[model samples]
Target: MACQSSLALGLLLLVSCVSWSSATDYTVGDSSGWATSVDYTTWTSGKTFNTGDTLTFNYGSGAHTVDEVSSSDYSSCSASNALSSDSSGTTKTTLKTSGTHYFICGIASHCSNGMKLSVTVAAAASPSTPSSPTTPSTSPGTTTPSTSPPATTTPTATTPSGSMSIGSVRDLAVIGLGGLMGFVLGVF
Candidate 1:
């Protein structure tokens, strides 16, 4: 009976342990934000926040704090601290959900001094599937016009009306208007 009880407990614990893997592995300010979490405002390759991924801040300094700021794209910080400046900030917080998350260092107005960062969680795709772009039919039910000089069809030219072609009338009218305007200006 004891052996069966032990086996059942082991199975239960194993099942619980294998429930699910963490979707996010955010780090504190890396020496630089290259492919990882950066301080201030940026992310690298490994720091990519994806859909359904919750980011947890890690501090490296004792004087650092994650300040949630107001943002239009993503949600603000979840919490802040006056002593989270450890290069590996410990007073960390998790991003509520996958979206734009803007945070800054909140220490004696450190943010106003330009200590901030932003993260955008883009939608994730399945590894076994490919995503395709949606395209709308823009053609007006017509085919592309051939570019061979429009087939070089011989176009018979048409003559203008009133015995005056456009070229002569355009020039004559311009000269006549100029003369009339000059005469009026002189009289004035």
Candidate 2:
């Protein structure tokens, strides 16, 4: 009975972790939205964008326009030949690929006054590598090395400071819910 309960608890935890690891939605400029007097560069400095995440631009209608432009257009702050433009005061763009996406306001002198945003999206989540194994010793002062090759580890990516990851928050919530369910099932 004890072993079965442990197994069930472990499975529940695994399922919770897997379900929370997914895409997230980010509101640009937070409450300030896409408008003048807001420093978009500083606003997005601490966020880690990933492919499939959504970027939402919120602003007043007719006051500003969101234009998806090329790197050249972004550099020049020119929206005359933008790839796409939206003036609905709210725009949502899903990061379809792992690359840099540039956006700017088509209004006069808006892009020049820090009304542009450049988001760099990373690739989808890859399988995490296990920890490296330590060398074993037979005696306290004497050790024998094995013929096995050294383990290679991939550096884990960390979210930026002052920013919360959507997955991390959801993961915690899922874990708590799993624990509650386990307790109700007498698996605690």
Candidate 3:
């Protein structure tokens, strides 16, 4: 019975870790919101976009329209061939692929006036996995130590879209604690 419980506990821990991965939601133009006056190019320059991440455009009602367009349409500032359009004052687009995405304001000359955005989406990051330590040779009567360099990760830059949530972190903590408790109980 104890062995069965221990196996179950370990399985739960592995599942919990796998399910903790999440994507981020970014608001375009930051606190300024999405507007013609905002420099879309500069706004997106320093940001890292990835597949599964969402891009939200917020604007005043009837002030602007968000249009997903092809590269040529975006460059030419033409909405005639827009792939999709939204004008409810807010628009959300999920980046589903690894490539370039172009958005423009189709309100008259907004695009020409610089109300355009282009983003290069990278592939979603793979789930992290535990790595084995490196073992070095040691002489007899001496203890050999295993060591490894810490893994380096590139931080993602995020813009505030108001109201932050730590739900994922909280969930992860709860899952981890439950797994630990289960393991302890099974062992003893």
Candidate 4:
């Protein structure tokens, strides 16, 4: 147990060393293909985005790639991060700019099947507050991750200058340990 926690702390330090930043991602195959390509594809149309936003593919999805077709195309997908093309079902490229983003499915006949999407994200109001992508669980139309926001009490105004430790782990591990703790304490 000590070894595992040590590993977790080590990993967290490594990642947190660099502030977290990502492009707003859009999943494929949603009913309307929001932030997705044509109906069955990924990349939504005219979905305003800014620098640092990303569009990631889903598990076991297709071999798709996002790229800028030409000079006048997808300024968002250009210059700063002119990624020619990438094939990763788990993660895709980030939209580092705001412009017409033209991406196509580089896989065979995928484009022909209308597996393409273009979106024009407006200039980011502020770089520090980049748009965050919505997850599938909280999918707009899905019943899960529903519209109702969690209830919570407001925090009191306060100031602090010190840092503290936090135990962050995969959800399953957290839940399993939580159950064990509750059972042992006779609170379950």
Work out how many backbone clashes candidate 4 has. Answer: 15
User: Quick one: ranking by TM-score, best first?
Assistant: 2, 3, 1, 4
lDDT of each: 0.50, 0.84, 0.81, 0.49
CA lDDT, candidate 4, residue 95 = 71
Query: Tens digit of lDDT per residue, candidate 2, span 1-188?
Result: 87677677767776666666457899999998888878888988967788888999999999999999999999999999998999998999999999899999999999988899999998876767777767665877875865686777756557667755655676577777777666657744
TM-score of each: 0.40, 0.64, 0.62, 0.39
Q: Which is the better candidate, 2 or 3, if ranked by TM-score?
A: 2
Candidate 4 accuracy as lDDT: 0.49
- lDDT string for model 1 (1-188, tens) is 65556555655654454443435566545444212223445344445565555445554465666655557312333334322233354544555456676666655545555556777776544234333443444588866643333223333324434554334445555665566556545655
Which candidate wins on lDDT?
Answer: 2
Models ranked on lDDT: 2, 3, 1, 4
**What does candidate 3's lDDT look like per residue over 1-188, in tens digits?**
87777778777776676666456799999988888789988898868887888999999978999999999999999989999998999899999999999999999988899899999998755555556544566788997555556565545435357633245455667787777777777677
| 3 versus 4: better lDDT goes to | 3
Which 10-residue window of candidate 3 scores lowest in summed lDDT?
156-165
List ranges where model 3 is wrong by over 4 Å.
Answer: 1-18, 125-188
**Largest TM-score belongs to which candidate?**
2
